[model samples]
Target: MRAYLIAAVLLALAIPVRGQAYMTDSGRAEFDSRVPLHTFTGTSDVLVGRISLPDSTVDFYLDLETLDTGIGKRDKDMKKTLETDTYPFAEFFGKLVSPFDPAGGTQPAVVRGTFTIHGHSQALEVTGTLEPTDDGLRLQAAWELNLDDYEIKPPKLLVMKVDPVQQMRISALLLPESESGT
Candidate 1:
């Protein structure tokens, strides 16, 4: 028993030895509506995300209520119709499958991961350009997510509202951790 306890402690201490936390609170996620009739856009604050550089894995979360389309009524309608209160957050977790030489500067990379929204998680791949700036890292990519994947029914209030598909754009700035406890 003593040996088992020692091993558990050692494993816990070892996990953080090479792990780092890079958080970006101001990361912006925008969704655009380019249907033939109306065009809309909104912004949201990314709650928290961390990258395990040693393992090339990343997981992030966003507050769903942060969505804004520049119009008040539309926003209210969306919340009410979509039941934002029940599904307040969305999350994405995936690994950076491509080789990333952050110290070498800017380059293009593709990240494959899973995205969870409205309680449903699905596999997704996003290709984007990455630039390691003096302050942190900048990643820009856009992808289309089918609302049905997450069971987000098309808002049908008053008829002729909402789009069949959602186009999302993400621009995130992730700062590197100063040191890894590991």
Candidate 2:
């Protein structure tokens, strides 16, 4: 009788709640840099941190070693040049600056946050569209970043041949806190 009661309680708890949310371990974080001489593309592992949906606060961790751009030598060069040993990770802590009401439909909001890279932090305003999906909240935004701001020097072979401009775009599936159970 005790076991039966325990199972019943668990089933009750498993029932779908209004604010349930879920997170994916395979979340993607990518960045690209295009110059007149060469182009650089890489991906980072999106590590999930604390997330909120109702109030719109979220945090993300990006593993620095996970940067992969197909070429092995370029990846190695980045790690050595950027000094990833000192900064193992980059992070973003942000909140939806505008009110988001998913129940009404697609919520238009700006996620104002600070992105830390290579021990340097920069205030960023990611302007984008956010919508509710069956899995979680999908945030799509394309933002450009300067390597120099984070003290990252663009790799060059001919000394003056490479441009230091880097462009980055990010799309994240932010899971709801209620469903995450954290």
Candidate 3:
């Protein structure tokens, strides 16, 4: 009887008590860079992310090669400039720093984490909105980053140089584990 009780307690401990974790592999991430002569955008829909409702933890990552700016030549140049061969991915891993109710509708939250790019990592805090949905949650955030901070050289076209600072946007629809099909 004692052994059976112990087994039952262990099983209970192994089960997730809070809300389920959600994830998706087709999330979107994009950046817009504006120069005096031109403005362009690069986007990637291969972002992989996970959000654990139990712990309010968030993690996201994507391949550098997945970014497309609509121009093949420019995309190739970006890949080489970003040193995709050396640092193939950009990632963020952190926990929610603000109050979050997974079932309480949309709310603002701050996520504190390490943002890694171009082989460099920096501590960052991003503010975004979290909205609960039937399947899971939708997260959206916009932030700015300076190229020099990551040792990334700004690209130039002839005499026109891209801005050292660029605006970044992220939008992801997270599906619960059961709906993730994995």
lDDT of 2 by residue, 1-182 (tens): 99999999877766533244434444577787675666768876555554465456757677778889899987887788778899877777898688777665576668789989889999988776777787677766667777788888756665434455566666667676555544
Off by over 4 Å in 2: 1-24, 45-50, 159-162, 178-182
lDDT of each: 0.75, 0.70, 0.89
Ranking by lDDT: 3, 1, 2
Model 3 lDDT tens row, 68-147 = 99999989988998999999999999998899886698999799999999999999899989999887899998899888
Which candidate would rank higher by TM-score, 1 or 3? 3
Worst-scoring 10-residue span by lDDT in model 1: 173-182
Instruction: State the lDDT of candidate 1 residue by residue for 77-123, as single tens digits.
Output: 77775677887777889987888886877777777899988778899
> How big is the positional error of residue 124 in model 2, measured in Å on the Cα after superposition?
1.2
List candidate 1 segments past 4 Å from native: 1-20, 157-159, 178-182
Residue 168 error for model 3, in Å? 0.6
TM-scores vs. true structure, each candidate: 0.81, 0.76, 0.92
**What total of clashing residue pairs does each candidate reach?**
2, 1, 0
Residue 64's C-alpha lDDT in candidate 1? 79
Give the number of the best model, judged by lDDT.
Answer: 3
Per-residue lDDT of 151 in model 1: 83
